[model samples]
Target chain A: DVKVTQSSRYLVKRTGEKVFLECVQDMDHENMFWYRQDPGLGLRLIYFSYDVKMKEKGDIPEGYSVSREKKERFSLILESASTNQTSMYLCASSRPLAGAASSSNEKLFFGSGTQLSVL
Target chain B: AQKVTQAQTEISVVEKEDVTLDCVYGTRDTTYYLFWYKQPPSGELVFLIRRNSFDEQNEISGRYSWNFQKSTSSFNFTITASQVVDSAVYFCALRNTGGFKTIFGAGTRLFVKA
Candidate 1:
């Protein structure tokens, strides 16, 4: 089974504080993504990394950043936490590479998610 | 820009009954992919189905079936004889042709009663 693990299942942070959400995949997938899930807005992409040290901004990348120092791990960073930024963070990994189907059709394996609340 | 839409926000069905969830998408490109995922109460997302644009043939797997209509730009999922275990939030997604980006719909919550 493909496993995607998130560092924290729940977290609370104060405004102006820095936060890091971590995700690790055991399948050695080359593509990783970060998304925030809200009640009505669904999952909006924050950032994605297709290779180590390479990252691309998604639709909602204004308030978030990411780091990928290794192939199996991807981290999402919030420069300064805000109440509006409090939401469920999901991390996903896909195998072979991005967009190309060297293996499967690049379906994402998502983490259980981390629900963050900023006070 | 490509987008996916799930018109139904909530659906209710009794055990052993049938239910259908509707999904519509917008894009001129014919080389895209569509997907459906389920998120149960445990909060873990599960992959349900994936349909590429070129393959328009409908699919049936046990009690779950999907109808893909290219002309209407719609892909609908139906569950025959729904069980209580089928209750969850269903999301429709679309992947662009040349990008790793996958856009998801707002999702529909399905409630299967005993």
Candidate 2:
């Protein structure tokens, strides 16, 4: 079974602090994603990386950035944490699909998630 | 813009009762994927099922089932003989063909009381 490991299960940080959330996947998946889950907003994509040193901005990437220096590790960085940045952060990885004809079985494997609280 | 809507915010039912969660999506792409994920108290989103655009067949696995209706743009999930362990927040998601980003709905929280 594929395993996605998150560095922290619960994190607390004060405003203006720099926060780093690390995630590693054992499966050699080509795609990695970061999402923040809120009460009513569901899961909003923060950033995604398809390859080493390559990242793409998701729907909500204003105060967040990502770094993927190696194939197994992906990191999400909060430049300066604020109260609004407090949320449950989830990391997921998946294998790349070819195209429309690709099988639907290619699903995402998620980590246990890091619940970050900004004070 | 692709969007997924899970209209049912929350549902509570006694054990052994059946419950259905509704999902509706909007997308212009001819080929897309729909998915249902379960987020238990552990906070990890577990992939439940995934269906592509061309397949409209309803599927049943154990006590869980999914109904896919392309004409209505809906993919609903049902759990028969619910148990306390089945309580969780269910999310419906949509991803266009070859797209990297997946859009998720607000989610429906199901509570099964013993």
Candidate 3:
């Protein structure tokens, strides 16, 4: 079965501390995304990578960054965690490439989210 | 800019009752994709369905159904007999042609009570 795996299901960190959230996908998909979910606000995209070393900022990229060093792994990095940054973070991957078979790429497979609490 | 709207923030219904979630989207592009996703209390988004602009057919998968009306720019989801396990936050999403990213609507939280 196709799967996306998140390293931590729950994380608690102090304010001003650096944090890392890791994600890996076994499907060999070409596109990966990171999003933060808050009550009522839904899931807001933070960043996405189409290929290794290629990244693009999404709607709310502030206070967050991403790294895609390898095809299967995508990581989200917070330079300094703040109380407001506490939210459920989700990781997703799309098959093939971004533009190929637009219909096929439209569907995304997501990983179980990471709930981060900034103290 | 592409945008998706899920007007219902929360809905409560008794078990075995039918429920529908409304969704409207706006985009200048002629070709786009619409999707519905289910997020349970566990917080992971599960892809429910995907419909493209060229296909206007309403789809039914068992007790779950979707109405896609291109003229009105609406894609609504309905559950024939909702159960407690059906309780979840449903998100409507849009992806414009040639775009790699998707825009998600503010999810509708559904609570099914027995």
Q: TM-score: which is higher, 2 or 3?
A: 2
Candidate 1: TM-score of chain A is: 0.92
Compose the digit string of candidate 3's lDDT tens values, residues B14-102. Answer: 99999999999999999888999998887778999999899999999999999999999999999999999999999999988778888
Candidate-wise lDDT, in order: 0.90, 0.93, 0.91
The pairs that clash in candidate 2 are none
Q: After superposition, how far is residue B100 of candidate 1 from its true place, in Å?
A: 0.6
Candidates sorted on DockQ, descending: 3, 2, 1
Candidate 1 vs candidate 2: the DockQ winner is 2
**Which docking band does candidate 1 fall into?**
medium
* Chain B TM (all candidates): 0.97, 0.99, 0.98
Q: After aligning candidate 3 to the native by TM-score, how far in Å is the CA of B7 from where it should be?
A: 1.1
lDDT of 2 at A41: 93
DockQ of each candidate's interface versus the true one?
0.56, 0.60, 0.62
Instruction: State candidate 3's TM-score.
Output: 0.95
lDDT of 1 by residue, A6-29 (tens): 999999999999999999999988
